[model samples]
Target: MALIHCPSCAKRISDKAPFCPHCQFARTDDPESLERAARIRQIKHNQSLMTHSFIALFAFVGGFALWWWGGEAADGWRAPAGIGLMSAGFVGYLITRVRIVLAKRSKG
Candidate 1:
């Protein structure tokens, strides 16, 4: 069997190992391993961003639509709703941006 690094125990374990013999870390080794682990982490992070982006896009669309409808709906309450939706989109964007910045900083 080939040798591989254990991210958990920081030990070199056998590629076929079900668990690290020295540190007892399980499912931490396998064939087709290193690339798979990196792909999994990247997919998870992308899913998180996509979810936020979807919500933000919906909010932005809703805000614009409401702003247009406000003129048609008497009393202009739709304008307020539109403003709220736009604000929500802005807040979501800011949160996402901050998270990205924090993640970058943490890497260094």
Candidate 2:
């Protein structure tokens, strides 16, 4: 049998499979169902991206606050720790934003 993609989860499966092993979706000839499943998966992925971006923003802001709270001095642990957090958060936020844009662009 040839390999086919599961309509529900988009995983590879045997064409002769009676049901999708990954998602337990029964084999069907309905195009609408496949479209609906794809939309749902995309929505979930977008939500996850948003959540990650929010967390990154929170980290960045918290780092900035910590840096200022420590009197903006370079001779303390707070300075280095805050800088590290800020860098990580900034990078993470940028990556997430790019992924969001790409995901939106890929909508079919």
Candidate 3:
């Protein structure tokens, strides 16, 4: 087997080894393996963004429903609570949008 430098730990390792002995980083010089790893990372990032968007939508809708329904109730706190929930949802959406933009910028 030939010796090569580990990409993660920068240590010498056997080219045939599946992982680095020092840092346990997966060793794959194949173009397909590199592409697959990049794809997986992208998929995971997209999934996270989707989750954040869903949560934001749910919170905003739930808050609006609460505000509408709470109007019939005599509680003075209901309106404020609903507004707070909606604001939180708005903040989450803004955060998600910023993160997506930053990711695209970094990629470019």
Candidate 4:
């Protein structure tokens, strides 16, 4: 039998199989069920992306607060450390947002 991708888990499986071995999703001729599974998966992925973005935003804010602490010129290590954290958080947040948009636009 030819190998096909499972609708639920996207794993390679035999086309003749009735269920996915990986995720145990039953394969059927019904388009509605397949579409439902795909939709659920997409929703879950979007939620995860949102969580990542939130964490990144929190980090960015925290870094800014740390850098701005006391208002006076940041002395030795704190300035550099805060700047580094801010850069990392900004990049992470941007990438996550891009991924979220792409995921939403994708059909499957």
Best candidate (score: TM-score): 2
**Shift of residue 27 alpha carbon in model 4, Å:** 1.5
lDDT of 4 by residue, 1-108 (tens): 899988887889999998998999999979999998888777777889999999999889878887988987566888987888888899999999999889867854
RMSD of each: 8.0, 2.1, 6.1, 2.3
Candidate lDDT values, in order: 0.71, 0.86, 0.78, 0.87
Lowest summed lDDT over 10 consecutive residues: which window, candidate 3?
70-79
Better of 1 and 2 by TM-score: 2
The better-scoring model by lDDT among 1 and 3 is 3
Instruction: Candidate 1: count the clashes.
Output: 0
lDDT (Cα, tens digit) per residue for candidate 1, span 7-79: 4455788889887787565664355665565556555665687688778878977887777774564246776
Q: Residue-wise lDDT of candidate 2 within 1-108, one digit each (tens)?
A: 999888777889999999998888888788987788778778888999999999999999877887788465545788888898888899999999999999989984
Model 1 TM-score on a 0 to 1 scale = 0.55
Q: Which stretches of candidate 2 lie over 4 Å from their true place?
A: 70-75
List, residue by residue over 1-108, the lDDT tens digit for candidate 3.
899876665679998999989977797778776666666666678779879988997898877777779356425787888888888988888888788788778767
Descending-TM-score candidate ranking = 2, 4, 3, 1
Rank ordering of all candidates by lDDT, starting from the highest = 4, 2, 3, 1
Every model's TM-score: 0.55, 0.81, 0.66, 0.80
True-structure lDDT of candidate 1: 0.71
| TM-score for candidate 3, residues paired by index | 0.66
